[model samples]
Target: MTLQQAPETVRVTAAVEERMVTPSLSVQGVVSGAPTREVRFEGSAGGAKQIVTSVAVAQDASIAFGDLLATVSGVPVFLLPEGVPLYRDLRHGDSGPDVSAFQSLLTRLGYLRGSATGTVDARTLTATGLWYKAYGQKLPESEGKPYVAVDHFAAATGEGTVRLGPTVGQRLEPGKPLFVLSAGQQAVTARFTVPEADAVKVGTAVTVRASGGASFAGTIASIGPFQSNEASKEQRAGHDVRVELSLQDAAAPKEASTVSVTVGGQGRRGPAVPLSAIRQGSQGTYVTRELEGENSSGTPPTRDVTVAVLAQEGGWASIETNPELPPGAKVIVG
Candidate 1:
């Protein structure tokens, strides 16, 4: 209808079915792991690869391995003891791919000047020896025997030679590493090193938030094995603790994003309301209540209402309308 050409009214009536109106808060936060873990591995050219350091378990406030050790380049990151570390059975086949993997690591670490194609070349082996010698690690000889840890990589010739230990400019052999290098060089942990001043008792409860607005309601299937406050939900940091939280259904996160964590905080129950819907009177605050609206079943109606002003924030107010109010009650806003 046009503003000036309004039609006469026809009265219509409907029923008001009582329904429950639940409200919640939408909090913005970053997710993180409350606990994490790591494992390390060792391998040589013609020897059985072993997990020398094994799985390093840190918990309760211990430092994680990722925060301490670095990974060897050109190797696949692996979770060992069950899953196979990358490049396992390399001794049985042509060494091309293996050489490529090694070269790939070398290229990443600024050691090799060629493409990461697995070919056992003279320069590659020499670079490999240089890497170990530089890092002060032990390496098997050309025949893959035991090992002599290299001390330094420079001779008195000033710039013409690269030493392989106490030996002056020992030449590197093909298909053999002068020093040991493996991708699974070390394992990492996901725990944070809590300060002694802030560290809680062993069984103290801690609250953790999830990344990208995850949830914490419903049945908690499990708690974390360790503790840390350093994990970021954005996955930006190189190392952080990870906590696994499972839910009964996928939809619980829709209700609320951040759960009010109660480590040792007092817990209580209170009525929640919108900040705008509330208003202050001489005695207290009040909210506006509508006498009519539509129901979830898709029928509109009206009923008696007493609006209680609970809270106010931003442009909105949390008001408590009549509990008997229908799902979609219309109210006059100020």
Candidate 2:
């Protein structure tokens, strides 16, 4: 008599899911700079011996046109209400592009009248007096005549927050950086090793999170050339690639601050399962499912199903199958 053996119960377990995911890469970076600049205050009056006697504005002060920045040799150096930098001194008789530009600014500001002739005459002096009076300063009459110091304004273009470069009781030499202006816009820079050079590209969207600060979004603006240097005694060689990011959000961390940069891996979603559920064999990568009904041999029947990997993250593999997988379909893990 042939004895029939009961079918052996085979048990396998696996975790499954149907969730959306986006691919990404994360790296470390630093805040490079702000959109504003640290412009140096040049000596005005085109003289070799200009000295600063007093500083008017405090650190983190908002600077504007006609605002007194410093008092040089008892002369108030006001912020000019113009965009272009003053490259030369303008007196009562100077004529050039600078004079024309100054004349035009004064004319537009209602401080001067008539066309800009690029020549400083009585009209220019009258305009200068009006400008000084408007700012509550005495009409500057150095050497017994109305004059505009070449470095008269000691101002920078663009209104923004200011950082004092020189302290009070300090002298501002000619062509020295007197203050730094924060323009409110900022950028971040991240460096990647040689192995990661190809992965970093310009225009790639990135999420930047500053240390102990709010998170912001940016795009890779530029990638610098490769550089190699000697490492340590044991590790001889190392390479690096520099990446600059232009941030869209204004509330950025301070410059030279460290931040985290995440880039790449976007636009993919599907059913996710344990990585073990994915099997690689002679046929290719696939998953298996045990048939509900048993074979004549009284054993569970199984079929191999092909699948394409969409993404892998956090021990889960997102996949696409030829035949759609049901929401709760059982997949073999081992």
Candidate 3:
């Protein structure tokens, strides 16, 4: 009689006893700077066409408080702290947040003493005159009274560099943006499918990889509403959600560039198995676990254990079984 042949042994991989598994979705993204506000010309040209006389800073130059932005028709345009637009001219005895913010600027420059009282007092006027003098400009005057003119300074929020919009010899229009102030911080923007949006949220950690193999840690700063593109014969309509990521302790690409972003979903700690090992059957999701001893047929014994998939990531799946699958358990993957 011929000897009975051993049954074929199936391929298997060890199930991770316990670990945190988090699913990650990769999507294309773009790097950009955070824009705070657009600096606009708020001065009335007094019926005369406002013309850019000279440019003090170049395009993409770093500007700060007390920095001259441009010269318009022989009047210097200085950059100042963000506040209510200097609608009307400010002079001694004017009291408001605008006046207070200006006074604070003067104090910071050592042109004014003590805290800003929100009132343009004698000291405030003196400081203003000194500030203009320091920049080689005469204090603007109307009716023989020295005052801060609306056209002399532009309001910019945040502390960062600015991008000049107006060039020398360009006509300046009141209420038109002259420059854009950026917060000097870099951020990444990307869109995710609607299904993936449910797993991603604000403050979710992500990995950003730029061209040339550079990578950085980032966090989800904001989530936008769902958007859909109009469907056409060539392409099917789809919905997606937008997300912005703030780079942490790293400089992003200077110019706008394409990047790859990997966003991780919430993690769960539990027993896990190779994603390939998970199978769906009549009883539901389950995995085939190999037994320790061989069966009477001389083949390895195995049984299917029903499991609830909690999370999956990186080729592994976290699962829950009735009888907890212990660490180092062998599971059939092939």
The local distance difference test score of each candidate is 0.33, 0.66, 0.72
Candidates sorted by lDDT, best first: 3, 2, 1
Off by over 4 Å in 3: 1-14, 17-27, 30-33, 81-85, 91-101, 117-119, 141-145, 157-159, 184-186, 190-258, 262-272, 276-325, 330-334
TM-score of 3: 0.57
lDDT of 3 by residue, 1-334 (tens): 8999889765656765688888777877778766666876666556877788888776556777788888887889988766644566888788898887777778887899899798878888888888888877888888899988877887766556555467778987656787876664567767664334444667777888888888877777777765555544533222233335454233556547988888766788878888788776567567898888889977678889887776667777777744646778888886
lDDT of 2 by residue, 86-105 (tens): 57656777888788888887
lDDT of 1 at 12: 36
**Candidate achieving higher TM-score, 1 or 2:** 2
Clash tally, candidates in order: 21, 4, 1
Better of 1 and 2 by lDDT: 2
State the lDDT at 288 in candidate 2: 83
